[model samples]
Target: MVGLTLLALFIRLNAQDGILLYPDSYQFLLVIRGLAESIPLDAAMGAGGDAWSAPFYRLGYPILAFPLHLVIADPETAAKALSLAAGTAAVPVVYVLARLALRSRVAAIGAGLVTALSFSLANWSNFVMPEATAVFLLTLSMLLAYLTGRAGRAVAVAAALTTALLVFVRFEMLLVVPSLVAFIALGAGQERSKVLPAVRLYLTSLAGLIAAFALALWWAFGGVMSGLSVDPTSLFQAHVIESTTAAHQGAPALSGLRDFLDREPLLILAGGMGLALALRRRPDQRWALWLQMLPLLLLYGLRNDMRYFALLVPALAYASGLALDEGWAALRRLATSQRAAPALAVSATASLVVLTIVFWQTDLTN
Candidate 1:
């Protein structure tokens, strides 16, 4: 299934429609090409003043593309290639995460296929951005932290490194690390003695990550404070925080849930059902899922942009796959089992294919 998923994504991504998908794609290409031309990192910018440091996004994507820029000659092609590879690699990682969490082969494969075929997901691969890579690393980190009931130091270290790298890939990933630590600590099983050590290891790894990020920033920006100040404090502002927590009138609150439902109705229905199922049957997994999704949720509520919703697709797809798989299973037991099972599977598969095409077309036409 993993191999097939990879092939499917590769074929899709490799097909060029000659559309420059997003503004970010052009910026990424500029950065990659500039760096290849020996332009300083801080000086890498687009013709339109899209600076490398204006809002202080992570540098991992451009840095990772340097070798590709050197080898591929065309910066856009290199960037697309990078996204394609990262997005393709994420399929197996998504499978591992779903399989580990649900302990169900059908659910895991379904998740993998959903992720692989998702137009929103595959769209990332066809573009020149870090989202696909970020998704891949983020899912890998989640899997590493949860694969065992009690993770050892090596697993903790690996998970931490993956997460830290993910942060470098995209700064928003930083928001979820604390919750991830909590998730890792809970994975230490029921042994009280093992719990403290596990917590210590995860925290220490987190500290190491922070220090590494600080050092990288300091080197790039010339000082820790300077690097930190690249983005204004307003960057942290959100409608939920402003309305409910801070009760500030500076920015009007908005309904992210409503916007998501309006934009991606199918995903909202299936993913919401999946989420309810998780809350009911796999309460232990809820924290991790929330952490994975909360940043995007906040972004949606604050900005009301549907584009950020793509970041939540991995969790949504995983949850939806579980719901779809289990729902079909229960239906099979209640009726003419074999025939109903095939019918349900066929219908679900067809629905997914149609949704994928629709999403791709929508994004492209936009």
Candidate 2:
């Protein structure tokens, strides 16, 4: 935990040279500054001084940074501070999930280290975007899912609430709702008699919260569809799905895959090996991991935004840690001679370090 905290602080403090604002960061800054004004709803303005509104972006991140902005009086620093704090909080959450679900302390520590150094996630801590917060929320959900096996109604309710709040951070988080429910069901399987009761309690709480949220939006906007600016399609009154999807269409799906491979080849490769290992050794956890990864897979296949890739960092890191541990065990078995074992261990560590450097350099060069 001390190591994780130091790594998080280092990443946060060393993201950029000077100015922390990026293209997306500035967009969020506009919203945050707008919210600081007396009339927040219509005060949002872009760099061009034109009125801007982002209904799909969610107000959660802005609200969190508003107080900090007031104190610091600098939009960029305030935004970065909020993101840094959220990203830092995610370190422990990832560790706990890896420990409980993967059942390996070494894997847990590796998970924490990987998450702290994840380029996509760490870089965003310098931005005003909500990606860091999303990572934290997702990790918390994973942790809760793992704990549901031993917990009762209170934990179930807490899990439901945490998952529910994720939607306010990113609408894509809604995909996790079904995944969380299935995970809780898997946990409930331990107690045959209590399975239905557990699932019912979880599902009921999640649904009720979502229903209330929808109703509030409906009343505020005259209709839920109105809040999203619905557009009619040529066919049978079908509404066009509008959000950030258009911005994601510029890049090809294969391009995103290539970028991920370049940025974190070892992590991605080890994660795949770990996935297979988990499937064989721990089928229950393997399924939960897959559930969490579904959104990232879909995004890669469809939208292909690198920023969206932060969603998979925690899961990939956890899987990579497991794979690394397995590789060490396999190498030890392969080296039958005591002298050969020591030599192989040194070689393996050196090779991983070299590979990490090469991948990071290649990713940056690309």
Candidate 3:
């Protein structure tokens, strides 16, 4: 885990030419600077000037980055630093999730290693945006949700809190609510009697936390809903209904998936095969994880933004690791029967490594 994390950090560090800032990055930087300097929310919202909102409503990322900003005295560097830290930290979280899903240390290690080398994850870590942090929190939420069955009440509470925090980071993350509920409802494994109570407990805790968070925001800002400038109905119509209609009309439905496959062919192929195997094997938590990924996949598939697919990197890497592990196991079984199997396995593994390197280089150039 330690090695994988360091490798992830190293890749992110070398992948950039200093801090990469975007239009959205400036919004976050303004908020981080405002928070660090004790500027009020309303003042911070207008800090950007020219009527550009400072993302005060999704304040979680800037709030977390403020301490770094205070020390570094550079909001851009601080924001990127926070992103790098979160992205690197996700390595172990991905490994843990893989371990829970596959129940194999080798597969878990493979997942961590693949995540470390992921170009998309590395690219996002280089940017001063909320994506890296959101991905980390999302992965953590998935882990906590997976743990609820084994750890019971405490884990359920933790999952709820994490889910609430995730939503705070990215309001769109509220889409995860149904998936989380499904996970909790079916988390108790074969303990059919415990499922309902566990789901109820999680829902109650999540509701309370969300309410408390809203109340705190309202008290601090003088109002909660007033800070948000977006109209929910319009946003839904534009982002959801319109996007879907457009996709069906002319835009390719699977463009986003195709973009990812072109960039990370081996990883995508392996992940697809692994997911197919998981479906056949029907692992205990397979459906929970799949449910969690469904909404994101659908949304991004419609949007066709490859960058948004970064959110799915860890999960895909986990599935890739599972596929690789299964392949190795099959080869081992063949090796016991045929003398040439060992040579074939070695050749196949070498080819995969070389191909992965080629893909990584191509992605870096792009």
Candidate 4:
């Protein structure tokens, strides 16, 4: 299923209809090209501008594309090729994360199936965006972090570094780190003495991430997110500029989000309910989910909706798996104990397919 998804999305990516998702799509690609050319990473060269402040988003993708850019003068195609690969990898990463979370092979495959066919997700591959790569990197990092927490001390150090790298890929991933912290703390038997040390370690890892981001941004662009001179205290105003500018560069954020939900209400609702159910299973998980959703909510509530929510499709997919799991359990209990096997399986498969179709079809391909 993961292979099929990779082929499906890669074919679509290769056959893109020349639909540039946003005006700024070229900025990142161009910046990578310029970086390859050894150009200064300043707005003069496209780094410190509103068009692109952080050119190293998912640097793993661009690094893979470095050879491509060297060979192909048209950096857009090279950069997008990298995006496509990362997007393809995201399918398996989603499966891995879902499997880790749910501890079910069938559920994991089912979740990846949903993620792979999500048109919204596949679309990211066709563009010069970091969401696909970010999701893949962050999800993989999340999985490793959780597993490390389960394993104990030696793995925890590596987990810290990997989790930090994940943050460097996408800033929003900071929200989910709590799950790793919890896993680690819990692994330490949650003894009172262990909790404080775990907290200190997590904070230290987070600080390392922030420092890494700052150093990378400074070295690559000579500024922080373009070195915009916004006051730290004026976070609201600064965000207003960023949000408004981002909308102007593409569609109004909220408007597009509203359209997405309107078109795929059932799927979105199912995903949300699944997330709620998963969170309800544990208090710490609830806090982690809350942290994950809170920033998106705050940002979208204040401005246009982000078109890149599909990039987080794996997160959505895991939640959807939970929803499907619950519904399947309920239906099985409702039907005759041993007679409705075929019907139950058919019903479950149908719901999952419908969700995949909804996600694929409703993508804002423009």
| Winning model by lDDT | 3
Tens digits of per-residue lDDT for model 1, 1-366: 657476547655555476465755666665566557755444334445533432235467877876888999888888778888887777787787777667677788767766765555566677777778787777777777664226566577777778778877766667777556546655654554665566577668867986787577556544322323344243234212322332233534454444555555455666777888867876766776666676667655554333455677778777776777777577667557557767777778977975665455435334
Q: Write the per-residue lDDT of candidate 2 for residues 1-366, one digit (tens) a residue.
A: 778878767766766445335555665676667656533333234445422233234556776687798998887778788888888888888887777666778788778877776777766776778888888887887678656655656577777777766766666677766666656666665675665666688778877876676566445433322323322122112111322354354666556566666676555766777777878876766766677677657744444556677788877877777776776666767677667868686867877985666447323213
Ranking by TM-score: 3, 2, 1, 4
Inter-residue clash pairs, candidate 4? 43-48, 119-360, 253-304, 253-305, 254-304, 254-305
Residues 130-166 of candidate 4: C-alpha lDDT, one tens digit per residue: 6666766665665665555555444655666666666
Tell me the tens digit of each residue's lDDT in model 3 across 99-181.
87567887887788778777677778888877788888887877787678656776888998888887777766787777666
- The candidate that wins on TM-score is 3
Considering TM-score, which of the candidate structures 3 and 4 is the better prediction for this target? 3
Residue 290 lDDT in model 4? 53
Instruction: Please list the C-alpha lDDT of all candidates, in the order they appear.
Output: 0.64, 0.66, 0.71, 0.60
* Each model's backbone clash number: 0, 0, 0, 6
User: What residue runs in model 2 are displaced by over 4 Å at the alpha carbon?
Assistant: 18-20, 43-56, 185-189, 192-194, 213-253, 331-355, 358-366
User: 2 or 4: which has the higher TM-score?
Assistant: 2
Candidate 3: segments with Cα more than 4 A from true spot = 40-54, 181-187, 221-258, 283-285, 339-343, 346-355, 358-365
Model 4 spans > 4 angstroms off: 1-15, 44-73, 179-202, 216-240, 244-246, 249-253, 263-267, 279-285, 331-366
Cα RMSDs, all models: 5.5, 4.7, 4.1, 4.7
